[model samples]
Target: MKKLFSCILCLSLMVCIPVYAQDVDYSDEDYWYATCSKVQTSQEGVKACVGFQNYLDDQFNKLKEEMESYKNDLGSLQLNSSRIEELAKKQKTLSDSLDSQVKNMENQIVEINKEIEAVKVEIEEKQKEIDKWSDQISTRMINEQAGTGTNILIDLIMGSSSLNEMFRRFSGIERITASDQEQIEQLSDLKKELELKKDEQERLSDQIEEQKERIEEEKAFAQELQASYDQLAEEYRKVEADLKQKLQEQAAASNNIPSAGVISPSVEVTVPSVSGFINPVPGAYRSAGTWAYPGGGMHLGEDMAASIGTPVIAPADGVIIYASNPAPTNGGYLGNWTGWPYGGGNTIEMLCNVNGTLYAISFAHLAQEGFGVSAGQVVSQGQYLAAVGNSGNSSGAHCHIEVINLGSMSMETAISRFAASADFAFGAGWNTTATACEAGASAPCRERPERFF
Candidate 1:
């Protein structure tokens, strides 16, 4: 009866051990379990348990420090993101203004061309009048030199019936001379006016040409700015992707425990309950799963089309794992300085628990400085997250959402799988590539977001 009681006591003690401790190696009977068993109820056994607890505490503390460092980095990234959004908007505005100016200049040039044509016609008409007057003057001079004018004058005087008639003829000749002189003077004045008009036309033409050149220069500058914006956006995406990967690594690190040994008995663990997902965007939303590449690569996330500044909400209760501007850092690959995230734009990634499963939810292409949450922050379902925006590689204002099953695969793999199997509602026949996950590259495995929404 005493032996049986002792055995029962040992069995009860084993059951009391923590599930985490069951994996610890006690096979070397002479070391851990052997000493503990020798004085199972003594101070030495208590000391051993206390030592293990201390080790676990130390490990937890180290993980806490690492988490804090990651949080700080996330904060810095968010600040950068904010600045990038500002710079992007400024650059876009400048580009648009330049475009408008160019268009206005083009219209002015067209009008100037019309004016030049009209001036040319005026000058031609004046030249024709001048030519006609000069011809008349030359004919008169020739007639006078050839004695025709003298003969006419003598005949008129000799054949006159009275002095009054002769005086009338003389008056007629004087009037004719006066008219010719007036015509010559008018022609000369017209030539001067024509010359002035030509000069004015020349000036206008020069002005138009100057304006054209200026517009071209402005366009070139705008293009440069756009290119810079694109590069910065790429850089921002790369950095953001790197940060997400880091976060994943940090999570994996937190879960990784040193294998101590094996336990003969299995333990049942209970998982906490999770909530269902809700629509991330309120009101009217539209999507066609047309996440194709014009910006670069495949569209892994479904775009929820909405007006700019439309409110974005959390799909479920979760902690924000990643949030940042994802703006480029190289001043947009140009000598000019500007910044903004291009592809995903302002992004927020949350790790949600849905029906006891972990899901990584991403919100992309948000408005300028529109994020309402940050990394490590807890958010409730239907909570405001951001506003729809046309930032990044977007063609219009929309919110891009990607749901990744953390339990099944990486986000990238999940995306590829969904793309392969999902029905295309739009952008069909477009090429889709998973370069991010291919060739051993790390990326989030994305699932069909429509399934959850």
Candidate 2:
């Protein structure tokens, strides 16, 4: 029995310990070695295991502290939830701004193209006009020169028909020459202006390109930052998982040590369900009184509230043991079913042996028919046994359950000798009805919840 208890406790402890790796201060090398290298045999082994377990816990706590500090730093920098939200808002604003900029740039490009096209058309028209004017001027100059030779140029310029006619012709020629020169100059200036306009359009295009590059850089940087945040979150999760596993393991190891068995005479006992079980009331409650004294400060069996006359079912397969009327001794008024000190009023008990372990299932706050089935009646899991009622000293309608563990001796004697086991299984002021029956005396609690068929 001691060996069995030790093995079960060890397994449970292992399951409870956590395993993690963080920035741990392992400066006490001697302690670590001593804690880790201790062999199992006596109480020293148990102590060493507990010390190691505590060390692991301390390491995890340190890691948690580091993570908290990191979280604070992340807060200082715009990196947490609020920061992400702000960044998202900023990103949206930037996106909208970029969208507007792109549209404006596109519109500008279109307008620039139109302006360039207009300039090209104007340049073409100017070129044609310049060519026509040049041809006309050349023709007039040539004809004049042909008509009046170099020697006649001075005479023709000074004299021609009457004075008024000569003046008019001279002015006409001067006006035409001046007008042609002016046209030529204007056409040259227009061409130079067109070239400058083309240069301005190119510069506008460069600006658009620069804006695009800036947007891309911002997007890439945002992605990198998000990736880093994801990595940090993942690392935190891994560390937490390791820490939990190590804690479970340490707990398992600590509980591996067995209690010294107390010798006692065996009695005719009935065991309960091995695996499948459920709450008879299907709700929560608190115990208001004890068997000895009805009114009590400390709670007894756990109680669960239900509607008046709610059907109470058996949690597991067992034989009806005891079904009794509510006694005045049981405390009636209690808090909500969820609260502590579960109360049981009228009680019905069932006894069954599971994997060599004997257990009793007590149903409290039963209606008029305490046990629907008689004693020695076989019950299946979730079988309706009776309707719940406020028959006992219960404030409301609720069911009280008790799981009694009969050790090698009676509860009365076991408490005096193997108090440790008694305390573990059935201590005072407890509603122990919520018990997970074991397959054997040494089996772990892994009961399937009861279900109505």
Best of the candidates, TM-score: 1
lDDT scores for all predictions?
A: 0.53, 0.45
- What global local distance difference test value does model 2 have? 0.45
- Give per-model TM-scores: 0.34, 0.27
Worst lDDT 10-window in candidate 1: 257-266
lDDT of 2 at 301: 38
What TM-score, to 2 decimals, does candidate 2 have? 0.27
> Model 1, 1-453: lDDT tens per residue?
224323533453332322234345433422532232221232334445334434434543554454344334433534254455555555555555566656756776776677778878887988888778767766664454343233344667677777876766676656555656666556556655665566556655766666677677767666666666665454344334434334334534574311111111122222233567888887746653624433542455677888877999988777665566543211122111111112455666666667766676777667765568764566788889877776654534677776655553433333333233221111111123332222232333346677777
Models, CA RMSD each: 38.3, 32.6
